[model samples]
Target: MISAEPFVSGKYLIDGNWVDAKDKTTVINPANINEVVGHVALCSEQDVQNAIESSERAYHSWKRTPLEERAECMRAAAEELKKIIEENVSLYVRENGKVLVEAKKDLLRCVDIMLQGADEIFEWSKAESLQGPQKVIVRKRPRGVAAIIMPWNSPLILTFKRVVPAILTGNTVVVKPATNCPLALMAFLHVVESHFPPGVINVVTGSGAMIGDVLCTDPRVRTVAFVGSTETGKDIIRKSASTVKKIYMELGGNDPAIILDDAILDEKAITRLRMGILKAAGQVCSAIKRIYVHESRYEEVVGKLTKEFQHIYVGNGIQPDSMMGPLNNKNQFDYVTGLIQHAKDSGANVKTVGIKLDPDTWDQGYFMLPSIVTGVNQQSEIVRAEQFGPVIPILPFKTIEEVVEMANDTEYGLRASVWTENEDLAILLADQLDAGAVFHNNHTIFQDLHLDFPGAKESGLSRETRHCGMEYFSDSYGFAN
Candidate 1:
């Protein structure tokens, strides 16, 4: 007897219909060696036009729907999304190469994000009443069909960040997920389509260069919410300017984590730091790329971190014991490995202290050993650039002001963390830091879904805030004097 496909439907969803693309795109499980786990239809220009046209058609009624009704639909969608968490969690681990446990957490986070938007963001959506003689109320309406270009890193959460909030605020969405990681988004869209009104949500997967222009340049697209590299974000901004649609961008980050001398080194702290640097193979946009340790504890910290790092099992995420998984794709793997090697070439001492990742299982896959590099010159590329990999460079610092200057020295400042026993110092450093958000005594990977998420300078513009989805979701909320 023969087995059946894990997922039978292999087409794109647009306007409440399962549609085919001009060509089929192969989706290989990142954990397995190019295993044909699933498939997604690659959208063409025509497909983009169709989805946008459908969104426009639905906007008239969707935007006009009472706030209560819209909120109910959002609640339903969130519930539906919650129900499929386990199913898509497995797909995320297999397709995106995240640890199976983390993958499950990612899906749960998505549901939590949606539920928050449904429960709280709507509370802010109501128009307030004035006391004097006149009822001047402010209301936030949907901006029409938003074009969300989601990144491959944490596909589920990134996709939910835009899709759930956009829809809950009455804006229809036409999503274009990164080709490298589209399965989770595709599955989530299916669940959403089943509950929401037709044409309210649509997902099309394909190369951005080809189909992305349609979303960026088209007049029908009222807003573009994107998460990716700074360069690509700029391109989207330039193109979308023609239509003058609102742009919300969450781009790259070269974040740092500071370890103060007074901080205690518990087993929990070392484990958290290790996970922060190596989670998702360090492909996370907010991963701790640079570790600035207090010179007093530098040696001890490195010794403890390396010892803990050695225990991580790297292999196919299907295995229960595997903690670290392979990189998303080959290009990312090569780029990350190149950065580590270049750091070594630049006189940085690189050390691998992880369960020896066997290459035999990844003959045609992307994989790398978790590594720590020390003796790195502060000015070197490894310390300065955003190497999105399971790697970290250690640099010693003596003074608080000195470390603060070093942390702000880089061009990218998306996020960072400060570990110190002194609450006053942590608060002071958090305020002075150039990054968007700073955590006290935590790794840079810490993310509260309800907080503001955006970068400064080259890191990007306008954050994705959690509680106040008002700014992120409102179609046009501005005041006139």
Candidate 2:
């Protein structure tokens, strides 16, 4: 059993103070459900209100603070966060069931995000002048208090992605982390809150069902930023409609990867495919779920992928040699398992690829081997739904037009990639695919901070990163002299 003394704080960061909740909830390690990793507060409705009020009160003054000063605080917070990177990574491994390497990447990404937001403060807050107008000047102003709800899949990076930009643009924020994995993120926020003045940044932990509506529908909240399932995003939209507040949502994704006839089937290509499907155990929003390969290269590509999958090691994340870990919770494990079983019942060929490192502990935790399915119908549940687990389906297409139609048939258009040696064909296919972000000769897992990342159709409604990211937390006003 894991020791809880180091991980448990049993408190929430509100108005720059670590406040205790009336009740507490135990957090279990996903790799060993019997092991208690830590405990967090189950915040009450009154606690939510207190956080909102604190943020609202701070917004008035925070908005007027100089941009340079705000950036300085963010840099200081980043340095402070750097000091705890190793500890946070270990906590992340236990709390979220990600292997040590993946957990470390998540923590470092948070630092990068915080520093990047600091660097962009000046560019985002600069005033623009128009020559054609009558001395018109356009300046960006902070939206009042913001409510940021983060997901459990990648808590730290996603939380700071919104928090850093929101605070850097002078908007005070109240963060609500996913209930299943809140300890690591809440602890990190504790470090961050110390760098800022009281009430500038706050955290509330509890059941989202209990306090989500309260956070989004609150009259004082001017912006609601969220990253989760599509259904939840829709609910948030309806709840915020009464106040008509600005909402930025990064919802579900059923990303596709098209393998053209001329695509290389080498080690690099196989590794990209492997990482895209198995990274974070396939819980990422942009994970490659559907693959369309040219009929001629289908057999060869499958052979390569199967070999790559056979080499993955699955066990507890803290184990040095383990490559993948368990699902974040029982519900997610059950959901993904149901999808896999459904595909099997529909007459699809299912193959379990990876080796389980610890057979005795397999039943003790939410563990499943990486599954690869072939001969799956294009319209099957496995292909159409976001499994969000370590299950991927490979299908063959006769022609380019047929594959393009199959790829664009889904309602989700969050991200997609095309792999081909022909640059001209890659670009053409990318343009034709219905996704927010498309890549040529690569997978969709790679990201660039300076690019505009947004979703199309039901995938998402707003953009994040670069200018769009900062603007999402602010409003623009035009002044004439």
Candidate 3:
């Protein structure tokens, strides 16, 4: 099912053209490291400088482009994206090392975000009339250039989330895709870039350390949008402070899934819970990292979940029946395995499930079976940290107050979920939880795209999606007569 052209794109897409860089980096499929995916050009400092210069020059004109014209461009880009998305699904799975189903969802989300932006941006673009003593009129204007620094887990969707809002609001953007899975996203970007002005959307690949800070510290870039670890986000914040630019970040999340006493353990609920834990092999920023089950139902929850996880098929991404793929890179694979080893050494009872499709070659890949760990304290390394792997710790608690305390005792407060048949209890616990978005019943990739996703506490700063985040791309100026 592999094709030759799924990952062919310009090295540095600046000024609507592909310029090759001197250094090249090879990309390997994490599922089978022996199988090389492709090679990407590692951009230098000069290449980054050229991109910012091009983006700044385009910003002056792009910001001036009429609203109707910009709207039409977005619509056209959305349509083009729709036609090519399905074709690129296979490429995404191979490049990103996620299952086929997850890869499809990632690509489709890109089209959905683009289409939604094309329509909703117009709704808020209108100037408002204020009935004040001075009769002031308020209008939101573009903030020149925006820098989009993205992560690899769901590169296309995460990149588009920032790219759509930034460009549709009349601001030019420079995108830095994660070094791990940059090619698949760039293929689609190539199509969208052809429709826009020469330098309206530029992309630079390779190491973020070499050229990441320039985008944040540059005076021309008025806003920085990023998705990654808390440590990296903090670094970006420090760099962005130099220019005092606005920043939109979605950082690390130690998401908690609380199982209330009245929690429904039907097949559907169990499936949804497993999804929350295993989606993208639990590499998602908002995945259920730690689960707190009521004491009365702890045994049943573990038993049911163990059976569910056992049936899961772990294999290469290209396999149609693969439910989960390997970790995206060696660094992550090593980090996750290390956490599991530490837990095991600390006397934690670890239960592993899932069948490797090819057991003989499993050692050659960065694959790990799904695991459930118990007998760990709240301060245990696995319990306190974000595993970002297939391993999840299931803890039992007697009191709601105690469970709430345990769940909130982490630096990450991105998202959490409450699973229960009682709606009142779910709402009450949701209010008490320290997460930004609380889900009832299900916590999958399926979410209302219109809702505002605010990053609470250490998880992130500001908000993402919906009206609040869309507004971050521009500034509102009031004119008084």
Top candidate on TM-score is 2
Error of 2 at 29 (Å): 0.6
| Residue-by-residue lDDT tens digits, candidate 2, 357-418 | 89888898898899889988788999999999999999999999999999999989988999
Residue 146, model 3: Cα distance from true site in angstroms = 0.7
Top-lDDT candidate index: 2
Evaluated at residue 410, the lDDT of candidate 3 is 90
Extract clashing residue pairs from model 2. Answer: none
Work out candidate 3's RMSD over C-alphas: 1.6
Give one digit per residue, the lDDT tens place, for model 3 in 410-457. Answer: 988999998888888889988898888898987755355555676699
Off by over 4 Å in 1: 1-10, 129-136, 357-364, 444-448, 463-468, 476-481
Candidate 1, residues 343-441, lDDT tens digits: the string is: 888878898866645566755567677888898868988888888988888889999889999999977889899888899989999998988888777
Model 1: which ten-residue window has the lowest total lDDT?
1-10
Off by over 4 Å in 3: 5-10, 130-134
- TM-scores for the candidates: 0.94, 0.97, 0.97
The TM-score that candidate 1 achieves is 0.94
